[model samples]
Target: MNGQPFQTPVEYLKGVGTARAEVLKKELGVKTLGDLLQHFPFRHIDRTRFYKIKDVQDDLPYVQVIARVTRKEILGEKHTKRLVAQVQDDTGVMELVWFQGIKWVEKNLTAGKAYILFGKPGSFNGKAQMSHPEFDLYGSEAAQRKGNLTLQPVYSSTEKLKQFTLDSKGIQKLVVGLLDQFAREITENLPLYIVNKFKLMARADAYRNFHFPEDANKLAEARHRLKFEELFLLQLKLLKNKVLHTQKFKGAIFDKVGPFFNEFYAHKLPFELTNAQKRVLKEIRQDTQRGVQMNRLLQGDVGSGKTVVALMSMLIAIDNGFQTCIMAPTEILASQHYQTIKSLVGDGFIEVALLTGSVKTKDRKIIHQKLENGELKILIGTHALIEDKVQYQNLGMVVIDEQHRFGVEQRSKLWRKNVIPPHVLVMTATPIPRTLAMTLYGDLDVSVIDELPAGRKPIKTVHLYESSRLRMFGLMKEEIAKGRQIYIVYPLIQESEKLDLKNLMDGFETISREFPLPQYRISVVYGKIKAEEKEYEMQRFVRGETQIMVATTVIEVGVNVPNASVMIIENAERFGLSQLHQLRGRVGRGAEQSYCILMSKDKLSADGRIRLNTMVKTNNGFEIAETDLQLRGPGNIEGTQQSGLLDLKVSDLTTDQELLMLCRKCVEDIFAVDPQLAAPEHQVLNMAFQDKNAGLSWNKIS
Candidate 1:
């Protein structure tokens, strides 16, 4: 019918005429033959079981039955018209109603005729009823497909679609129209060796069985093959990008560990580095020593000392006579890094400067001049560091904190600041699940600081319903009496009419009334507050002038107060797992034991309960991250780009982790054997990369 069978427009299909095809494209994005094939069923239902009308329960998703049409009638007229049919089984009677497509549906109803019915049951006046129930002559195509005893797929459809005869049954028919063409059109994307080795179904058979299986076993096999293919192709493309990036972009070599690094480590180091930190530093050291530009992702929990690792790596660059910069997502973070690094280096061992939008023009110009003249050894700032006026003489490394906050384009600007791309170390406190990291940051080498510094006690976490508000306040008072500050965070800055949760301003008022000023000063900060005011409030908390800091998620990343011992999150269920973990990290920085109280409403959704329970159970950021990945699913996780490789149709990162790991290993094994896919057996993968359905445009999340 066209250049390629799969590429043919859906309008040319057997059942889908121009009108139906237009509806399909507009509603479900099913335009080409391939798009229709890829629209998988969310679930399948058994057709063998038929329930008696008397046994029909509202709790059941859908009730199937064989019954006789006792009476049929059309009510109202024109736009307000409806068709109602009363069906009777051996035990009882049920009403089947259709509000839309009344004229066409009325023609199909025949009173006193035996037929099969399928629909979600609802009770009306103690009678079982189904609106727009599916029906056919008792034994004629009752399963909706011919000559099959397997499960019937239940495809999702909209009310608009049902009006145009494009319900789930309609869509199934369209798919069935293409069944005979699968073997002729669906070419094998995976090599024969891979298929045989993995015990995978053939490409054509997989597609057919996935849509309409002859049996449950065929369906399971089809799913396994498709899921593996989705994950494998994505992994293969990621590995290819990693190889190409390493080859295309040359890295600045930093082989020496000079005075700046050794001086701090020997005399000025604040504490002993954890083995995890040391191991991560060694990984960075190895990445930089290689000639290829290092693109490494450094992951650590809030107090895991990633900044120190980053500083040490930068010192390696400085040792090799190259300048380095650390960029943060916010100005507050930039200033904090500057202060921390300055105190750690013990005044003038190595020059460090901060540049942000709030920095005065005079100071900014001086920093810019120093940077270009090679007088500034280390620069930490927000986006201001990437301005056109800010140029480095020999920028060798760029460390990005909370790298997900910055886009790919902004990061690329730093690479352009030098002739050759600088070594990149992207740091994130949000611990990503291993499966997620492999797919999201697969192109970059990853190093994780999993262990916290010794002697730092884990923050004690607890969950409390809103009924225990007084108890939470008591804990806050107790903490403050012990000379420790407290952090009270809210989900919203102001009252939300849509959400019935406590807001920051209301919380501040509540705390002000309870704690009462002069003796206990509280700082209120949020996104809408002026930057200077927020900083001043934060400084007050840091200096112990304010015993309580009432704010929203604005301080989730930037604020680090060793004296802040208690973190009370109002509507904690509203916050995600990683966010709760980051907030918990704000405390426990000091020797004093810290506490994190998660406050939620009594009525919580299952996901909300899981999130709160996870926060209360352990402080392991990675463990919390894995649970979050499972709860929210890969697509809903914040900061993770939802398109490209993450737009997984067949493979779910949550439940299919084993397959994900296996597929990644397969990609690794293939690359080990033939990185370029030049081998005859590997050529199929190269072709898959070109096909969207096979590989789906393997791209990294920015």
Candidate 2:
């Protein structure tokens, strides 16, 4: 194992005990010696500047000062006690306070002694204060540094880790110890040619300098090398998986579009296929015809007619003596899809049924039987489709709607339902940026249906503050006068769920007062409402029985009502851009002109303003998604939280577009020639591609 390179457990390290290692593992996911080494510092502090106490401002993040302690005391009762010390620079004196570890701090603080004090500055009762400041005796190692030579790495540490003396300084010591012992053990993982071409720092030196850099330039180089290496490893894994999958898996070939497809395209088709939809259908049909299993991701903005493309693909499967299923993340969406497909196909065109958690036991058994006997040609459902008892006959393909909601394991379960895994067509309404799409779904071929259906008009979006509630009411009443429905949604954040529910109720009350219930039927829905109740309320709106629906973000994913021409999102600033776009998509489905009114409070953050502005600015989900990625970053993007692929240390998907593209191209170039990386020069690259995430059933996040 090359002297057990990065695999050794942290407990075996010189200074780490079992307790400390456990804390490290729990808090930092640092199970192995390698994890510890790769735990790059969050930031490197340049401890070269000293400021006068008089110059300290509360707005400053941190300030360092050369000061002498003039007074020190412990105050308050035992439980509420704190250690407070006054330190004086030549300009002025500032109070330093420590809430915890007061005894140890009080013991160390000495009056009439000089110290190097550093911490965030704040004002308490118009006097300067520094809380829990880090200090060292003046002229000690920490206080004697000058310029970049004084750069100190600060690792992230949890309170639990701190209890075991495994805070940033403690973690640093362990890393330093490990580096001294095993720095020579890290061999170059990259091919020598590629390394020379990129002029990347050696793997060993990069690891060392990542934790403890020599200078700003070396630190920068080390950071770039590490980021490049991480992206390279990820791309290598994805590209290799693609090659191996193509070679090993066989797909069901639906070579002909037969009666079901022909008949539907001839008479049952609801609308003329947009060019984008037709192009996507062609791509899917081509994938299914190939001997290799098709793994394609279909990206479309809302109302882009992707469902028709998916249905046509399914019809082809039926004609080829195969079965297909569509899995939506929500029951409401699944039901809507069932209704849409049912209406599109007309009566008895093909056998179809809805399966969900609420399905009756007897009906579920019947549906299961139909699926097993190949009587059900198409099944539309939620995650209930993936249950162990739910079997499919000749399951040739599976289409996952809002594919991000399902974990990789669950998706793979559906893929493996057949003797040979079924072809997978993953569809998402949320737009992904080009670079992120490549990184997240690197193994799947992607097709984007960028064009919306004809006769659909872009929903006019406008921003309004709370002061304009009366104006919103006027707009709502005007839309209702035209026999149209309206949707009023509130933010439902977990931390402030009570406030959110209160807001929703208050909105309902306000609307109820404006247009009394006898004159206007209004329905309310939120996460706290019973599932059946929520469904009833949503179905009322869907059926045009309710002129206005008061709800929370639960309506974001599903609940289609084309007649609902107006959507008012209260506290619109609370939502991310993708969410705002999705909410806006609920309207604009009907041919009639639609409107989305963003209602936010006066105090909007810069990003909040950007989000609301973007909604008003464009209907393009891709553009909205790019803006979202830039504002919040990749890690916080909709479905990427659980994706270990985004556990990037230095590389940012938003800003590292150039680097990501370069890495992808380099990997693709190698794969095109080697296919298996069999050459001598490529062996190091192959060897370095260790599956650290092995033994995981849900290996792929996509």
What value of lDDT does candidate 2 attain over all alpha carbons?
A: 0.87
Best by lDDT: 2
Q: Candidate 1, after superposition: displacement of residue 20 in Å?
A: 4.1
* Tens-digit per-residue lDDT, 1-702, candidate 1: 112676778899887889888888888878888888888888788766789999999999877889998889888868878888898978998888899978778787788788878779998898899998877776666445542335788788988889888888788887888877555678888889889999999888888888887778998999999998888888887899898898899988788888878887899888999999999888888888889999999898898898888888888899899999999989889988988888888776888999988889999889989998999989999999888999899999999998888888899999999997999999998999999989888888999999989889989999999889999989988988999999988886345723423466677888999999788899988777787888888998889898999888888877878888999888888778888888888899888899999998899999999899888888999999999888888877767754455887788898898998898888888888888899998877887766655636443333
Error of 2 at 176 (Å): 3.0
* lDDT (Cα atoms) of all candidates against the true structure: 0.85, 0.87
Worst 10 residues of 2 by lDDT: 691-700
Tell me the alpha-carbon RMSD of every candidate. 3.5, 5.2
